[model samples]
Structures are given as structure tokens and as C-alpha cells.
Target chain A: MALEMLSPALILLLAAVLIGLLKGHARTAVVLVAPLLTLWAVWQIPDGVQGTVKFLSYYIEPVEGSPLRRLFATVFAIMVFVGGLYAYRVARWYELAAAFAYAAGAVGVCFAGDLITLFLYWELMALFSTIVVWCGGTPAARAAGIRYAIMHLLGGVVLKVGIEGVVVGTGSIQIQPMLATDFSTWMILIGILINAAAPPVSAWLADAYPESSSTGSVFLSAFTTKTAVLALILLFPGEPVLVGVGLFMVMYGIIYALLENDIRRILAYSIVNQVGFMVCAVGIGTQMALNGAAAHAFAHIIYKALLFMSAGVVIYRTGKSKCTELGGLFRTMPLTTVCGIVGALAISSFPLTSGFTTKSMISQAAVDENLVWVYMLLTAASAGVFLHAGIKFPWFVFFQRDSGLRPKDAPWNMGLSMILFAGLCILLGVFPELLYPLLPYPVDYVPYTAGKVLFYLQLLLFSGLAFFVLLPLMKRTETISLDTDWLWRRAAPALIGLIERLLGSLGELVARGRVRVQRFSQRIAVRYLGQPHTADREERGVFARSWPIGTTALWIAGLLSAYVLLYYL
Target chain B: MANQDEPLHWLVRPATIRKLWIGLSIVLAAVVLAQTVVYIKGYFGVDAWFGFGAVYGFVCCMLMVLVAKLLGLVLKRPQDYYDDPDKDTGHGQDAGQKMSGTEERGNGA
Candidate 1:
């Protein structure tokens, strides 16, 4: 296949390969330019399957275009560009390279016209994001990266199995929306849910992301779960099971994040929480709902990356990550503080932020569908989100009881990246028109109606009040909450050890019994085969002694007489 | 580290914090009161009641915190929980089942 027609993802992929070889300005040039070129390529693809090619026996569409595809790809490319801006100065070369490769996979997934192509790109992301986690350059990162890789690879295998099943069953590789009603489709949904950080398997996100390098986490945050959401939108739209899964994730995130101490882990849990919204929207499956999912994904990437960037700067400066270890940073780092607050507000969907414009659409979808339970739960989750992430995060990390930490503001590049995303957050909020048209479907709902604004305002503001009133209860402890990862990291290994011990003891018992039986058999043999009267100390047979022949003769005579007497009787 | 006696950053200053709290409370109250003029159009009946957003938001956060606190009892572990794992594992940590004869065995056997 020609490289040019391969996909826009190739540009970034090729740049990723080249980045390791280049140095200084040349490397910087590639990092900065590649994503933009990809962006251009993304916009150039027109709607529908742009081209089709045969792979072995199956026809595969490597490049396809739709508003949804373009929208997701555009944000991904933008993320790489901005992420490069944020990390180029501070991050290691390998990290930057791995991040680019990981992003290339996400972009590839976006434009993939068939499940085969999507699965290939999905594995590519799984491979490189693991490397990004390892680039954290700590023991924790090493272990977490292994775990992250294992989970994604497992998820990848599940996905591949599902896709194979579907292709075999349907005799096609085309991407089409279907419900998870059968085995293959269920496997496909489950595989996607794992990547989406659904409950039970969701701990991997909170486990791995925080353990990655500051910059690595930013890139890690954007791709994996969001891409899973996209795949869900494409493959399993309107699957009702996702709504409950999403609700669980939403509540799970708030609770875990509220109990968390590490700054990045909090954000990571919230990633699951926010993706929950998109997953639920996909379950809703109406055009407006899908649009909500898409738009929310886009907005989430910006604000989340912005939040991570701010946190990254703080970690970089002070070399601390726990909420308890950080505070009063705003005293010196005004820019990071403001940027973080912007992200915080945006995440909370405050009246004029990107989150406000985007996330509310999901609730609107529920309202339109007359899903009263879903709507109410989503509204409550909105308030819950504001409590944990919007207020709790910034409050503890930037403004709470001073930790006597006075770190400088973010370096210029990091600061610039923050400013860029922070600006986008407000820009999209003020003029959601900037994003709405890019959505997969028409956006009929208005975000800024007075009543809606007042409602959200009250919800978020009173939640902020709840945060303060319950401030004592929100104590930051140096404790980690157990997650499903613990099942493997601790429980599985311990269970294996326990089984081994039991087997070892059982083996010892069997061996002892065998010895006892052997001794008893030996005694019986001695009693029957040996002459006990030969000597007091000798329990051995007398056949080997000098009188052996006489003893044998007497025994033979005694046996003959006994046989004759028995015959007579 | 800055001295404890020094004036706190204005943002965290007690007076500033107190005033900010009051101001934010007023804003919260104002939003709830705005419901009188604007229709929230709740899909659920209970959601349309007076100050539903405010009350619900506060209650949800409180309940969430309470739930988390309760869960913390069972789920919370030291940050180093997985780091060392355990030294004994399943070997000698258990008592009594250890074979007395096994310990007595000579190196030759």
C-alpha cells in the first residue's frame, strides 16, 4: 500500500518513528508539524468510504470519512499538537515519541472504515501507551506499565475475538451499528467496555495513569477511553446495558476520587466518570445523544488535558503529587492556579465553559427521551461531579490549608499549552457554534437558556457549598482505595500462594503415610519370612545361618503331617 | 516555608474565606430564588419542587461523601499495600502444619 493513501494516521506514525533519530530543532519541527499535517488530511477526506482495498480475503476500507470521524480525528490531531507543545520542553524524547505513536493509533481508529482496521489501530494504541506509562521512569511506573499493558492486551484480545466472530457470522468487515444481543456482539461490547474503563475493570485507569510521567498521563488520558467511547458509538449504539454501566462508572468515579489523595489519580477516576456520560449517551443512541457523546468527548479532552497540564506543572515544580502534599501553590503559581480553576469549572460544566455546552446535551437527550430516571441520575451525577472534581480537586491542590509549598508557575511552553486549552474551554462555551457544527448530527438544543443556566448554576454552586460544609469529611489521607486491580496485584498472587501451600502440606502427608505403610509391610515380611527365634537381637530370617537346612527339613515334615491329618478329618 | 505568623495569601485568609463563603452562598441562594421566575421544567416531578437543584445537589454531595467514608473503612489501605506484598506469603506464616520430622531430616537424606 502506498503511504499517502494509508491514512492520515500514517503521517503521525511516520513522524513517531523519525523522532527518535532527530535531535534539537529538527525533532521539535517534526513534533509540531506532523499533527497539523494529519489535521489537514483529516479535513480533506470527504464523507463515505473514501477507498476500499482487499486484505487477504476480506475487503477493508482503510480510509473513510464522516462528520463524526472527522470530528474525533480533528480533536486527536489537535491533542497531539498541543500535547507536543506542552511536553517538548520537559518530556523525554522517548516519551514524546511514544505519545505520538499512541495518538497515531487513536487517529487511525477514527478514520478506520472497517472493524479489522480499527482493531489493528486499537492494538497499536495499546502497545505504545504502555510505553508512555513506562516513561514515568519510576519503579511504580514500571509495575503499573506492565499492568496497563496486560489489561489493554487482554482487552485487545477480547476485541479481536469479538470482531472475528462478527466477521465470520456476518461475512463482512464493515463498521455498522448493532446491538449486543448475541455472543459475538456481547464480546465486542465487553471488550470495548474494558477499554472504556467500565466498572470491575475500571481500576486500571486509576491504577496506571497516575503512575505515568506527568506529561505521559496527559496523552494517556485523551486516547484510550475516549476511543472506546467512539467505538461504542459506531458499533453498539443504543445498547441499553451501557446506561447502567455508565451510571455505575459515574458514581464510582466520584466516590473514589473524593477518597483519593494523589492529584493525577483523582483526574484519572474522573476520566472514567466523564466517559460514563459518553457511554450512556451512546446507549441513548438518538442522533442528539450520539452528538452529545461526540461533542462531550471533544470537550472532555481539552479540559481534562488542561487540568492535567496544570497538575503536571505543579508536580514538575514541587516534585509532589498528593493533594495533602500540595496547597498554597496559587501563592506563587498564579497562572497554573487560574488555568486549573478554568479546567475545574469547565469540567463542572459551569454556565460558560466547554463542558457546559457539551455535557448538558446528554441530559437533554434523556429529557427528550422521557427517561426520567436517567435524567435525574445524570443531573445528580452532574452535581456530584462538581463536588469531587470541580471543587474538591482545585480546593485541595491549590487553595486549601497551605502546605508551605511555593512553587513557580508553569514554564512557558506548559503555560502556553494550558492557556491554549483554557482559552478553548471558554471559547467553546461562549460560542459552542465552534464545536456544534463539527458534531456527527445536528444540535437542536440550546445550552444557554435562562432556566437551564439557573438550574446548573444552583446545582454546581450548592455542591460547592456542600464541599465546604463537608470539608472536614473530605480529609486527604495518605491512603489508597482498593480497586479491582488489587484482585490481580494482591489477591490473585496470594491465592496462588495459598494453593501452593496446601498442596505442599498434602504432599508431605502423603509421603509420611507412604513411609509408615512401607515400614509396616517390611515388619510383616520379617514376621512371615524370617526366623524370630534365631537370636534375641536378630529379627532376620535364619535361612542364611549354619542350621538353615535342618530348620527347612523340620518345617517340610510338619506341613506334610498337618496335610494328612486334615485329609483324615 | 512562609512563617505561620505572616498574613496568609488573601485567598486563604480567614476574613477573605469567610467573605467569599458568604458571597458564594448568596449566589447559590440567588440561583435557587431565580426558579421563581424561570421554569426548570424537571422531567421528574420531585425535581420541579422549590430549590430542587440546590437541595438535591447538597444532598447528593453529602450522601456521596457519607458513602465514600463508609467504603473507606473496608477499601482503604496503606499506600504501600501492594509494594511489599508480604514477606511470608503462604509458606511458614501458617503454624502447626509444618512437618516436625522434615526439620529433623539430615542433609544426607
Candidate 2:
């Protein structure tokens, strides 16, 4: 009976196919309705694994339902709806179709009941997401997509290996709570961390995301890393390593984003930063931390997507994405400016926004657990977040010196999408109870105490002050900062080039040696064989020498007598 | 959108900007001053000091910016650093498509 119920992820996948083939209004109708239908389907599934298929001596559970799964799936469905609204008119058909398929993979991951199903959906996300990246139609986007693919493929391999190890070691593919204590588990954790945009491998995100078309990045921001956070929540909660890794990602995002100039890249790095909070919370692994992780992931999807949508509208209108190339845009695009600021504020965890309600729980977990170090650093990061995202984003893009460019505000569809998500950001922030029940664990936290609100305001406002005081130092230059991705994007190719040169020289040396050997052998042949008719030399040889005939006759006679005597003996 | 005929948007007027800054400073000062009255349940000893949030927030923001600047000294590069003309391989599926002379889209220098 449950199998008869349509899986929401399948609905989206089917819609992706229809989007690819259909034309005109028919396609738009599917694009708009699919996500809502998926949302309904997500709610329809009952708790626990409801659908199973047997394969290779194991039953794969393809569908499962829980508050956590539903929470992520609901937000994902909402993101698809808004993203479709924003991009349906602008994004290429292939991109839209691919993005939908990619999203379906994400939802699929959310419901995946076992490691096999998870890995399959993971690869699906990887494949279609690459198509989405290439849809940017620029060489950099194309190349970045490849690098992204390589990184994910590597991650997939690690994950698959971990899954196989688990299946063989335990003889089951069921998703279960596990620690990163063993090699297999560590692989799974690392694989998921890669998608979470965890450090060292995190560069692929910023490298590829900002290169995508404006609408594409909005979709890109929502699914991949958040799914990894979900996986970490499922598999590696309470793993202490993530605390350090997450903190590093937190600081890494801020510093890099602070140094960044591209509007989208700044947001891109901040994705790593935002996901860092969730990962850190998951590492704390208390019920509160888990709730914080899930809730933050949910809230983050809206505000981050809203931020990207705002940036997309700006780019769509102005054909510019760099802060250096853009300034004083609020003069022309009031709606876009306001939405950008709201998204920025939400991201900075300003009071009465989604971020403030959700992100504080992570620090609260640290405080409860007596992770004094984590709490301290996270607070510092909170201030830094305000500096880089909250103030810097809006300050440069909207209110800095005028650039003398007047662009129209977002089109009707884009504006509608921004308003939708911006409204959600505030609603969730103002009333977090709407989100709390959806979390995997029971809720026992209040985000808006008086002291808490005042503390955050003081922290955030002073950071704003620091921003202005250091305004000169924070100038947006037309530059790109290197990331670990440089190892493959730049250093790997350069390394290959160096090795090629070395190999070429080695071949050249061997060729010279061969030529010298040939010349030496040719001399030996000429000396012994009287030039062999190929040498093209004068015929003055040892046997061909003058007076050689008389000497040859005497020697022949003497040798004949000696040969006869020796033969007789 | 502001009216195009206006010489300057009212928000950007020098006088408006000065007033806004003054107002912003007052608000900042008041928020910090409110901390002295409001009992903040500081998590640690050092954080319980009056104006701790303001001082720490300002100090941390300054440190982030300065550190970012220092990193930029080594990490920042001309945007075109990665746009190698010789990238003849590793662009999966598009290995040989013409570089398409499309506008660079600010992806590189």
C-alpha cells in the first residue's frame, strides 16, 4: 500500500524529464506544480522505511519518513518551487531540467533508508549537478564543473568503498548511527564532509558556484552541502573531529569571503561558513545540537537561497557580479536591495531573522557541553560573519559610491520569488516554533531571551562599526583568492606541464644517445669491413691499400704452410 | 527605484549621510551602554565584563579584516591567473569545443 504512494523524489524526477521534452506553457505548468506535489508526497509518507526492493542479497529501502527527513525534504521542495519561479523565465531549459533532477536527488537522499540508496542518489546528484554547472556556458564554469566532478567522484568513491565495507563487514546496507572510529566509517564521514564543503576539499564550491549563471547559483546553494549535513547528522553525530573541522570552515569562509570581491563568490564561501555552524553543532551531538543542525540547515536554505536570488536579480539586470563593478545600486533597484539586505541580515543571525533563531543553538550546545574554546571561537565568528556577510555584502552592492549605472529592478517573477523567500526568512525568525517541531529531536530551546537579544545586537552592531572603520582595507579589488582547489585547478596542470617537459627532455637525451651509438657502430663497421659499400668513402682500405697485394701473397703462402702443418698435427 | 531625474537620491545626499552616521553611532553607543544595565549571562569569565560584546565584536572584526588583508598579500592574484590558453584537457565532455569567444563573464582576467 505504501509502495502505491508516489515518492516525492520520483515526482520531481519525472517532472525533470517532462521539463526537458515539453514546450511552452505545458512545461511551465509542470515546473510550478511538481514541487508542491512533492511537498505533499513528503508529508504523506509514514514513519520508518516504507518501501524496499531486493538486490544482491540485500533489501534496499528507498523510502523512509521522519521529522528530520521531512524537514529537509520540505525545505528542499520549497526551494525548488521558489527557484523555479525565479528562473523559469530566464534559465535555459536544460539547466532547469538538470537542476530539478539534481534536486530530486537531494530529496531522494533525504528519504534514503539505506547506504545503497543514498549512494545511488548521491551519484545522481553529482551527474545532473554537473550539467547544471556546465549550463553556465562559460569555459571557467565548464572547467570548474569538471573539477567539481572530480572532487565529488573522488568523494563518491570513498563513500561507496565505505558502504561496501559496511555491507560486507556487517552484511547489511541499512543506514545506522556510527562513529568515525573505523576506517570504513571514516571514509563515509570524509565523503560526506567533502559535500558539506569541509575544508581542504571545500574550494570546489567557491570555484564553481560563482561561475554559474545567476539563477543557477540559487539552486546550487541549497542542496549539496546541506545534504551532507543531513548525512553527518545521520551517521557521524558526536564525532569530535567535526568540531575542529567545522570551526576551521567557519573561519575559513569569513576570511576568504572578507577578501572576496565577487558578489556570488562571497555568498559561495559563506555557504561553507554557514554549513560550518551546522557541522559544528552535529559534532557536539547533543539533542540540542542535532536540533540546531537540522533547524539551521532548514533556515539556512531559505536565507542563503534568498541571498543568491537577490544577487541573481542584480546580475540579471546589470550583467555584473563584482562589488568593484557595482556600487550604489539601491538608487535603481529598491526591491532587490531590500531583499539583499534582509537575506544578509538573516545570514548574519540578526535578531528576528531565521539565522539568529537557529545558529545560537550551536553555541548553546558548546556552552552546555563546556566546550569553552568552541563557544569563544564561534562568538568571534559571529562578529566576523556580520562583518563579511551582514554589512559588507549590502554595503558594497547597494550603498557605496555610485557607479552611475541605473538598472531596472527584478522582473515580476524574480521579485515574487525574492519576496516569497524573504518573507519565509522573517516568518521563521519571528516565530521559530513553526520550524522547531519539524526537527528530528524534541525542542527545548528559546532563542530570543532579552540578554541574548541585547548581546547579539551589541556584537553585531559593533562589527558594523568595525566594517566602516576598516572600509579602506575592505576595498573590493578585481582579484581572486587561491583555495585548496588550486592544487588541482592550477598546480596539478602546472605539475603535468612540468612532467611533460621533463619527459620530453628525457626523450631528447635518448635520441641523442642513439645517434651517437649509431655513429660509433658505423665507424667500427667501416674500419672492419672496408666501408661495406654504404659508407661512400674512398676505397683506400686495409685490404684495399697500395702494396697490400704483394704483402697479401707472402702472408698467404706462409699461412698455407702453417695451416697444413697444424691440420696434420 | 528612485526617480532618474533627481540629481541625487535623497539617501545618498551628503547631509543625509552625515545624519545617518550620527544616528548609527548613537544607536551603537546606546546598545553598548544598555549592556551595562542588562545582565548578560556571559558564558565565560572574560566575557562578563561591561561592554565585552562591543569590545570583543570590534576586536574580532578588526582581526578578521587584518588577517584577511595579510592573507591577500600572498593569496590574491590577478583574476586571469587561471585562464590558461593551453588548457587543452580535463574539461570533461567539452575538451575540444571552441573556447567560444564569449564574453568572459568575469570568470577570469
Q: Highest DockQ, which number?
A: 2
Tell how far residue A454 is off in model 1, in angstroms.
Answer: 1.1
lDDT of 1 at A482: 95
lDDT string for model 1 (B8-76, tens) is 666666787789878987887788888999998766688778888899898988999999999999999
Q: Where does candidate 2 chain A have its weakest 10-residue lDDT segment?
A: A539-548
Model 1 has an lDDT value of 0.88
What stretches of model 1 exceed 4 Å from their correct place?
A: A2-4, A516-569, B1-5, B85-109
Q: Go through the candidates in order and give each one's C-alpha lDDT.
A: 0.88, 0.88
RMSD of each: 8.0, 4.2
List clashing residue pairs in candidate 1: none
User: What's model 1's lDDT at A569?
Assistant: 100
lDDT tens per residue, model 1, A1-569: 65435789999999998899999999999999999999999998889886678879998899888999999999999999999999998899999999999999999999999999999999999999999999988767777889899999999999889999999999989999999989999989999999999989999999889878889999999999999999999998899999899888999999999889889999999999999999999999899999999999999999999999988999899877877667767889999999999999999999999999999999999988999889988989999999889988888888776676678789999999999999999999999999998998877988998878888888888898898888888877767899888889888988999999999999999999999999998777676556556554455553433456787799899999999999999
Please tell me what DockQ candidate 2 reaches. Answer: 0.40
